[model samples]
Target: MTRKAAGNAPGHAAGNEAGEETGEEPGEEPGAAHWLFGDQLGPHFIDPARGGPRRDAPLLMIEARSVLRRRRFHRAKAHLILSAMRHRAAELGDRVRYVKADTYRQGLREAVGDARVTVHHPTSHAALAFVRSLPSVRVLSARGFLVTHDAFGRWADGRGTKHLRQEDFYRWVRQTHDLLMEGDQPAGGRWNLDHDNRQPPPRGATDLGVPAPYRPRESEIDDEVRADLDRWSRDGDVEFVGEDGPRGFPATRREALAALHRFIEHRLPTFGAYEDAVLTGDATMSHSLLSSSLNLGLLDPAECAERAEAAWRSGDVPLNSAEGFVRQITGWREYVWHVYWHFGTRYRESNTLGHHEPLPDWFTDLSPDGTDANCLSHVLRQVRDTGWTHHIPRLMILGSLALQRGWEPGAVTDWFHRSFVDGYDWVMVPNVVGMSQYADGGRMTTKPYTSGGAYINRMSDFCGPCRYKPTVRVGEDACPFTAGYWNLLHHHRDRFEHNPRMTQAVRGLDRLTDLEALLEQERDRRD
Candidate 1:
């Protein structure tokens, strides 16, 4: 189905990809070699208008070893990225010039020296800067997102304030694209269905009986990726964390579409009620496991949202389910993408609360060997094994703990970027700095996303098997999160006390008779 472009809406701004003042035009010259970034493997990125389908221009792809060597990434993450890039290159055959080099500049020089290159805007600020430095490359508009850079810039600029509201942007997008809309209004006379969606895990259930998420079968290309990664590790050229299990995510456009169809057909109906819920055995639950594919640019957000809305229109899915899923794609995901650029590079360094603690070795290494807390241990182990966990575990469990402990936001941001398969500089910066860490001091979110043990207990099955007690904030059996939540509030009381959203949590600190003991315990707590 052809969806309406967001640019048709009034107030849509126009500029180059992600509108970063790259001093390049969105238009590309004819017959220029088109360079594909790892994330830009979709059909949209190389539409017939951009010298694809007919093979009007040769393709340039670089497998820069420096990217892997610079960071100790999750082993599975490295495998997925390499596998995806190689898979795309293989599909293109002789049309693509795939180069493995120490650096991108070397690869670019090898592929097409001093030739005019037309490439889609890169996802990272660093990549964009590098491309800008290269005189041969011409950057085009970014694909895979619902909103254009200029459109988002116009929307954000019209706000006349630094704090941009996601809900307002979401509604505007819904109207602009006519997604899930009935004439001029939303389909169900509501702009949000969050209240219907936040249900806890079913009582006594170890798993939600939802159908399994799509898991891609590894092919010869995958074997090549794994062997190369193993060789790199053996040569001491790159270090990796986590297990390199069978590739769990789609690495090609075909596989990505298959995953999206599977999600829309089998899982999206139940997604809303338990998207925030966690089952120890059911890591995916009813959630769509398409973040990696979406991030990889194998699947477009517009297609995903449109399919979900169609499901609702056909009555195969609930209104809440469709709206909730659409909100994530067109609302939160798009908002994060725009925020990453609009806030600029300096946003990554925001540390309004002045948190400066270092991440512990165990956490940084993604090892759960010594953790007694069932929620923390289980979530960490999940990440170590699969390089993924649901958003609830990510925000409430992992990101929450980091916030409670006051780890340095920049380090925490880097850890998140390296640890997950879908993680990227654009995706994690605003998310960690503003939403997860609240290190931006309420620029993107109203308050910190951290929660006490009760939240974990209510939302997931992990807490049931834990050694620590959720209600106990004192003694040896006291839950770290339960105590740490209060400790966090106490430490930041001066900053959070007067804030409307944080007033209640801050006031709760005064009710704690064991406040001093809790503080002492959290201060000494390691691991």
Candidate 2:
């Protein structure tokens, strides 16, 4: 629950008695007046304004889990959370129950009766805020990252706010549970082998281990969500992608553990080199698709990293693969979450570079024409279809292009949030807008990562059939990505010019001029 230190500020939106938005404004502080928590905002922060519990009746609340990807399952977390709520409410035979973010508003408390009502939360943040909102209602934390009230800034010490440089919290997680960190050194002889696993996978390699997917049958509440999703589609374009099985998700801890083990033994070996490599139909790279489970509290971060460490120790996977995977969990993933919250809602709105370029059309298209050669058409297709993209394409290509083109950091974050299956507000805001876009002034990553076609070609097979050539740096056949990379450095030379690690890239840029217009023509018209 948010502490009510109500000192009215200038830009705080004023909440009216009748009916107006009640949320933190885009440019305003998050006060009780004008902030309207609604559809467009993340589902995590959509509940009642932070207050306390309610004085009501009937103590049954249900949380149904669903993954909404306009891509495969017409999947939306909205469907799962609300559907489970509905099913549980119906099972208990209660009408005063059932709170769905998809179909309800924040006024549930004001409108509900004396009997205690139930509200469904798609994420831990939503649940925490919901509990904080009620006066006499029950509260529950998600099995996963639902830590809202207890704002645990792992990076922050007793001091004001601290930047998490080392893997302290992650180390504690390993030490506390006695995970993979084992050896004469710490837990193991070494802490991580991420740096060791950088060797590229054997080219033209096809040792991809088969990945299993679960598609569950629609249970009781799914009918309601399906109905809502169908209705939603009539208004615009919402595709339906669902799994076909009994209970689609890995409901318990065991299934999630199995998923992790599979990655450790089979996938971890090749994860690092190919972590950035994209291939057609290779949805799950050597990487483990465990973010959803981790976010939902289905798996522990320490446990996950340790398992990868175990893979390396057992020789099931290489050190580089293990270390790289561990870095994603310990370094990147947690760092992004911390940065997002530290920056707060404003993090998503940051545009420190002042770039207003719209995201390129290729971002929303299927073909590779006029697209950045290092781009992932499939991943972009996935984003548009299901709201999800794999890490490499999302980070390297998508993020790289955004940095190169000078798109508003906020817009890029929104695209990632709106279009990814795993796009939680805490995660997406920082990674996309702050880290990848460098809108946060190098908070999470080393630099803006403004790269071009050459980087893409080095990592993936997506460029082979691409409309443009990755090799060409100028003129018609020149890959837009190639020129874009140089142009980004050229345009932002003063910024990245002195960056020591960026020196090599700056040297590469030395060949190009500040003529971004000509660069654009070289890329855009390259047939």
Model 2's lDDT to the true fold? 0.52
Q: Name model 2 segments beyond 4 Å from true.
A: 1-97, 100-155, 158-163, 166-178, 183-190, 206-224, 235-258, 261-266, 269-273, 302-322, 360-374, 513-527
Model 1: how far is 41 from its true place, Å? 0.4
lDDT score of residue 5 within candidate 1: 62
Local distance difference test, candidate 1: 0.86
- Please tell me which predicted candidate would have the highest lDDT against the true structure: 1
Residue 479 miss distance in model 2 (angstroms): 1.0
Top-scoring candidate (TM-score): 1
Worst 10 residues of 2 by lDDT: 1-10
lDDT of 2 by residue, 1-527 (tens): 11111111111111211112233222222211211121112222222332211222233332222223323232554454344445434543542344433222334433353434333222324433545566543322221221221233422545343344436544543343344544313433666554554444447854455454433356546766667767865665455432212334333344556777777766677677666666665656666777755665446665676567667777777666776776687556655554554555455667767788776655544334444443555555555444445776777777877777777777677666545545666777767776688776665556676566767777666677777888777676777677767767777778777877687777776555645555666446432
Tell me the lDDT of model 1 at 336.
Answer: 91
lDDT of each: 0.86, 0.52
Q: Residue 43: error of model 1 in Å? A: 0.6
